[model samples]
Target chain A: MVKKKLIYLDNAATSFPKPEQVYQKMDHCMRNIGANPGRSGHRMAIKADEMVYNTRETIKKLFNISNSENIIFTSNATIALNLGIKGVLQKGDEVISSSIEHNSVFRPLMQLIKKGVRVKFIPCSEDGFLDPDDVEKAVTDKTKLIIVNHASNVTGNITPIKEIGKIAKRSGAIFFIDAAQTAGNISIDVKRDYIDMLACSGHKSLLGPQGTGILYVRPGIELNTIIEGGTGSSSESENQPELLPDKLESGTLNTVGIVGLGAGVDFILKTGLDKIRNRKVFLTIKLLKGLENLNGIKIYGPGDAGKIVPIVSFNINSIDPSEVGYLLDERFGIMTRVGLHCSPLAHKTIGSFPKGTVRVSLGYFNTEGDIDYLINSLKNILKTKA
Target chain B: MDKELKEECILVFQTTHRTLQAENILKKEKIKIKIVLKPRSITTDCGLAIRFNAEDKDVIFKIIKNNNLSLMGVYSRSGEKWIKL
Candidate 1:
């Protein structure tokens, strides 16, 4: 029995084959510095504490955050988004979000709606492009927050976040960006972009292991603490500490996962973000061009390759997306995602609701050869259907 | 032996994070410091403290002030007796 080569195109879900340094650092941390950080005075514990702080500092540099303490680690981006959204909004607050938001932001905002908070969505074009003017028009004096997904996970369409950020600033509404799909794939400056709060998944674009995520809160944003417990500081006090990270971060952190995330950030810094983005864009263009000529295939998103992340969504005429997904995997040993991609709002906006579309999300590790193989496999699947 | 240990002082912090941070800042400034278990005579808010030459007290204070570390207290040890400086 021979094993077929695996081509992973599900990076938008969670990155695979993380950089070698991520694995190495995780292993080293577990073996050498496994002590619970901020809890003990032992050398191992201190080392663990340092590693966590170093990761925060790395995140600060990567995101252009001025203060390291503003970055909080969570289990994943969903948890981070919950913290960002729920912590800031109060009753009667009006929140504006883009049409293309993952369940991470959408579900949280839905929960907020039940709490008497009003939520409005800025509509995007069929190609998932969001006009900054729509976002500006949606802003009201009662609009306390404006949340935008930096990029669409399903269609890979990049939103005009800087323009929206400016509108949010001028309107005096706090701007929160969901960078789950864009953190490492593109450049984001929390300061220059006027982002007051940002959430991201370390496991996805950051190239870290699962169970790692980040939330950046700008200074002077007095967010209510959502989850409260022992922060390993102010143990004498019965209340949580009133400090930057200690105020937001409670309980013991994921030290091993954080160290790995730090290593992943280090790798990104060393390799350079522009180089990674260029390669991913080139491969996506190649894939899009290859599939453009195929019959019965309708590609989704902006279709301009460079305007989006390295993700492509499309469908075969009259065929269920899941069926196409299954055939792509079993027949060709290629892995891709199907269905709504966890953003039903995006699907409905793009007219792929209910059935959804076949999505191929490329990563920095994927090559032109991989794109060619995916195109050829897609062609073979289409031929069989005919 | 008692006099030799008495020449040093321990700077205790409220949290292990701050204790480690203080050590890093002091080390970078070339100030000799050692992370030691908090002396039993000192209040144990955090289990660790920075031990350095008592003569370097002013320089240590400057470093802590520059870094804005939240220190619990500073105490000098003399033959097991902890004296608040």
Candidate 2:
């Protein structure tokens, strides 16, 4: 029996089949430089340390960050969000976040709410687009931070972050962007956009393995350390070092995963983000058009296809989303995400509340043929149901 | 026989990783450089520094500035003594 081909359409969750360079660099790190970084003076340890720093430099260049030390690595975007949210907010401080935030940002802010941090949710339309004017109106004297995701993971709608950033800056609020869905796929400059803090997952758009993420803090933005321990620097002092990265990053790091992330960033740099974005957009447009032509389908988000990421969420008439997801996987050998996608607030915002959507998120590796296959599979499923 | 005196400079960075980064940048510019253990005269941070020809100070400084390498300090070495440059 011939094995069926597997088509992965879940890049928004975690990108699959990372670049070849990422795999090679990760293997090389494991074989050659496998040691604790920043802890020892031995040759292998130094090599490991270089690997970590090299990744930081690569990330800096990619994000147009001035100080590489401001970028701190974490296990995932959730941890990074926790650090950013918990580190900055104090009692009686107000935070403005969009309704389309992932659970990673939502859960942390909820915890802060229990501690007296007031959070105001800027409403998004059914298309998952937030208004910058609403953000401006939401600001108050107590507003300490404005957090928004660059794009919605469920609907793929790109938020107007630059405009919101300007509003936050003029209001003297620190702007924090969750770029888990936009990093590597969108061009973001911390200085030009007036972003004070950014949190992103290395596994999503960055194409690195899971368990890697980044948080960038702008200069002079003092965030109290949430997790503190051995940073491999200032060993003599029991207190945590008062530096940028060492202050944010404590304990041993994931050296091999970081090396892989560096390679992934290098690939993005060499290939150019514009080219990658264009490719993903092309695939997304093709998928959207195909889905639009299909019968009994309800598509969500800014359906224009040109105004979003490569993610598309929809539900077929009278068909449960989980059933569609199951059929897509079991019969068609296509992988996709179904239901709330860990962003129940987003689902509710888009009016997909009780039941969710079947999300088909594309990546650079997905081909036009793959989109055609998905469309045909959906058409077949609809025919069977009819 | 007279011994020839040579002037050398050491670029100290906060971490060995940064010292290695400086080494890479200088090498790419074709400046003569080497990774040396942090000299005893200087305060030890990460136990590493980059040694290069003092005559290439202008070029090396340009490289450091251009790359934004986190350099702790620069020191010059004379006969049996190290002086801050």
Leading candidate by lDDT:
2
Instruction: List, residue by residue over A213-236, the lDDT tens digit for candidate 2.
Output: 999999899989889887766555
- TM-score for the A chain of candidate 1: 0.98
Which pairs of residues collide in model 1? none
Each candidate's chain B TM-score?
0.86, 0.86
Instruction: State the weakest 10-residue window (summed lDDT) of model 2 chain A.
Output: A230-239
Off by over 4 Å in 2: A1-3, B1-11, B16-21, B28-32, B36-47, B51-85
Query: Can you write out model 1's per-residue Cα lDDT over B1-85, one digit (the tens) per residue?
Result: 2344448788988655567668878989988788777765565344578888888899989988988888889998777698998
- The DockQ of each candidate is 0.39, 0.24
Q: Provide the lDDT at B36 for model 2.
A: 60
Tens digits of lDDT, candidate 1, A261-313: 99988899899999999989889889889989888889989898889999899
Rate residue A114 of model 2 by lDDT.
94
| TM accuracy, model 1 | 0.93
